[model samples]
Target: MQDQGLARRELIAAGLAGAAVALPPVALAQSGARAPDAPRSAPAAVRAHRVEVPMPHGGVAAGHPLAAMAGTRMLLQGGSAADAAVAAMAVMNVVEPWASSAAGNGFATCLDRKAGTVHSLAFTGGAPGLFDPAVDPAELDSGHKAVTVPGAFGGWIALARRFGRLPLSRLLEPAIGYARDGHPLDASIAMFIRRQQAVLARYPTSAAIFLPGGQPPAPRALFRNLPLARTLQGLADAEASALQAGADRDKALMAAHAHFYTGPVAQEMTRFSQANGGWLRMADMAAYAPLWEAPVSTGYRGLDVYCSPLTSRTGLELCEQLNIVEGWDLSSIAAGDPQLAHCLIEAIKVAKADIYRHAGDPRIVTVPVDMLLSKAFAAKRRAIIDLARAIAFPRGADIARAGDPSLLALADDRSRGGDTTSLSVVDADGNAIAVTTTVGGGFGTSVVMGDTGLLCNNGLRIGSTAPYDGHPNRAAPGKRALLGNGPVIVLDKGRLKLVCGTPGGETIGQTQFQFLVNVIDRGMPIQEAIEAPRFALQADPSFYKAGAAISVQMESRFAPAITQGLSAMGHRLEMVSPFAIGSIQGVLVDGSGARMGGSDPRRMGYAVGY
Candidate 1:
């Protein structure tokens, strides 16, 4: 079990490319496809609202400012990028507990400077072995039953044990201090608590910390979680005690891992689950371990794009979407152009359909990862995109019937996981990491894992992928929940170039797609690319719901020309606030090798460097 939790890193890069990108075969066959306003034109760029100081050595970008500070503290202490991320994520557990905690699950894409390669870490938790399919699965939507075996803590230690230069105690110090002392609640986080107060109020353990005094804390109110501090400290003490007894670093980290999964923490969680009529057992927790595997990748415009693989359709879909989009030279397509939006939206629909149909736990279900990532397969799927019109989204099984290979898709994920958190970090050594952690919807299932002070993910809600018996993504015992939250990495000319990710259930992949195009295709600065207006296909995109209600949540910042043009093409648009679509946190390595971090102005996110 300990070996399953540890891992080694490696690197992979693509060859250089010509200035002009080559389109796949059968591209541009749409004679009826409408053309852009100009033959080959791009839009003017704007100055970024905020500027970041370039960091030659290291930098950190996170969903919150203090979390970024926690990372910067580690970087300043000569820690690696992995160390910075561990510290920052621990702080996120304390301050932004409603979004991501030690109990959440997610994926992290890493650029290992030593190996000169990129890899993905899978911390996405799986279904419990005792999950009973005979019961009404809807009951798991937002309660103890919705919780899965949390993989976040497993992932945290996996990274620290392998790549960290400091001890676990040092990495978790800032987070413990914050929880033991106190931190001011951000205005937005306070509003989020108020919104989810009803759910938090249902559980006494959660209510005690989140809804103190029977109400949500006001903005800037001092918030503290002493129990959470003690819990985190206990993990650190486990590692410390092991080292005192002459254990090596890796063994000590294993001791910390054991303390959580097999020791007191696991016992408390199982007891809570049994009392609350949930399914989690000590076996599931003890056997849980994050996996380290090679990332899936594709090449576009001379840059190598990489994504986390199966169990999360995010990366697989990303490769498919990019493969479809790569069929055209996007250099002339500006960010503000309606034609650009049209092409992106269409590509997303195609990729979402295929991934929804085929993606699942590779060890359990049959996922055509190779076929889906192939250029030939993308060419076939690209044929379905009509340049001038929006195909009724979710194109359903008809997409598979239309020559693309697909299995029956009987389920879908409609949870608006806007409460997730994403962060990107880069150390001076060219080591870069992008992490997206979440508890599934806002405030997760609102079930605190007893005195462990952990809020679990509602992955079992809506069956993570679906609750259908024949579906690849259906909920099953010991199966990892298939997700769409993807943290992305971009490499140019075989070198680490950009890392970006965000929080927004289905918008996670779409946001990363638009951001990559902004930087690689249009050459915009990282911050400007992040702050640029974006759109998300909020309506269900699963193959099970073809031709269903389709809604596009677009930021109001888009000019009337883009919105009207999209509306004319059959996309039902819901105009939201300028920053409503996504909160992107990222870091970019410029041609000069300077690293700069960018945090979305949409939220209280910030980047720190020294």
Candidate 2:
């Protein structure tokens, strides 16, 4: 027993020594500045639970530690940013099933370090071909009818074919392992599960997987999803078989795509939906294809900001907000200054008004993209902002006169809840990817596919349910939803500067915009930029029930003086939790080839580097 005790002590000593050695120089210096017996790592965790990792070779920041590590593993295997992103996303689907899933949809921005070009991949879910527009909005918001034709699998295959160096099977191995062997449920996930117990209980399959004993799992409990693992393994096996059958890279990818969208998987999904009275069909699955397009870009100061175009209204909204704020010298404004917050809030209101008025699926509507992105248009909209007073743009005002009021109201009433995940990665070769994914509402209809363990998305809930004639966003066959996802890449002089994104539904664009200002204008580090208190404008009337008043939601961490100042400026103020806004993950790679990764302390996210 004495020998065993001595060995345990030795092991602990060795671990401490290893941790000390692995500490960054800055961390070591800070440790030295404190008392010798004082805990160095403990205080760091208590203060912010994050550090700006300077990755000389590669880095990844994701919503969960396991997901980030999976991406790092891919980078270590000499994979491109695209490969790492796919690996991370797959792991996220298993670990963060409450927020995202393989059955969900997403958007990605990949930056080619060599070519200095940014590409936008739009895998946003679309309505099934036989979608029932007359269904109750409440029904579409949850349950089987809410499921759209998933695009994430096809998206992964496409990204791999375009830029990955490793096989799709290898990229997905980490996620498959985690799902099979089980991972310890973290505090964040545990809390989410507990909160969602009632909702999850409505579906037997979901309850069986998430609540094994009719209760939420405690933190650190081992959680496994063998069915999900098998599903992923089957996909990997299919991809391998296609490659071995003399299929070229693209052909192999297409074969794998066919396996998911046009083969047995599609048949199973169609059968399940039909049995459950859902809307998905074999034709919808076969017709689905993820779109790849050049990212919409606008110059902000000296840096060029790029975002997903068309179906995602966030890009134009972000550009217009930035343009309006560009005329002001935000650098001179203090970080928590109320006037600065007011300006940002007002700018968002103006931008959202334009988004509601015009933004939609480009295939079905003339989005007037150029006009909305124009500096002249921004200036005209900027003139309408009453900085001293809060403004509430009535919902459906522009479309009301153009369409049936009842239909317009139904379409405008659809608002997405903030339930999504994000990741940002930068490889050794300077390639980067920023990705945002969601399953629509949290827990995503709370229904799991029988035996498959796939939690289908309720993405259709975010789409316009009203069948208004000529309305761009009205529910239609094969129409992509108007998503708020805004994965971003920032470039300066044709060189990559930053890759960042967040998952906050309506708050996605606003949070990203604030991050840019904090970093570029305030000269803060990536970690500091994310940790800073933020204000969100709840001015869009469409986001609330009828007669709900517009107000500004501010983090309690902001100075009372600032809140008071905003109140004096005629803005309604509502104090919220310190970390209640968006959880942003990002990486900044500078000209010197130094990459720093940042993860939000608001959630159980982490950043890893080498």
Query: What local lDDT does model 2 show for residue 392?
Result: 62
All candidates' lDDT scores? 0.81, 0.79
Instruction: State the lDDT of candidate 1 residue by residue for 76-106, as single tens digits.
Output: 9999989999999999999888788898998
Candidate 2, 1-610: lDDT as tens digits? 1111122223234332223223323322223324334343223222233567777888899999999999999999999888999999999999999888877888899998888789999987688887877777788777888888887887888789898988888999999999999999888888989998998888887898899989999999999988889888888888889899998777877777887888867888888888888888889888888899988889999999999897777898899889989988989987557888888888887787667566667886667788788888777777777867766653422333333234234334535574889999998888899999888778777888766678776766743322344556766777877777889999989888899999887788899988888888877767878888897867433542233356788889898878988898888888999898898999986667567889998888889999
| C-alpha TM-score for every candidate | 0.89, 0.89
Q: Find the 10 residues in a row with the least total lDDT in model 2.
A: 1-10
Error (Å) of candidate 2 at residue 25 is: 19
Clashing residue pairs in candidate 2 are none
Q: Report RMSD for candidate 1.
A: 11.9
Query: Tell me, what's the RMSD of every candidate?
Result: 11.9, 6.7
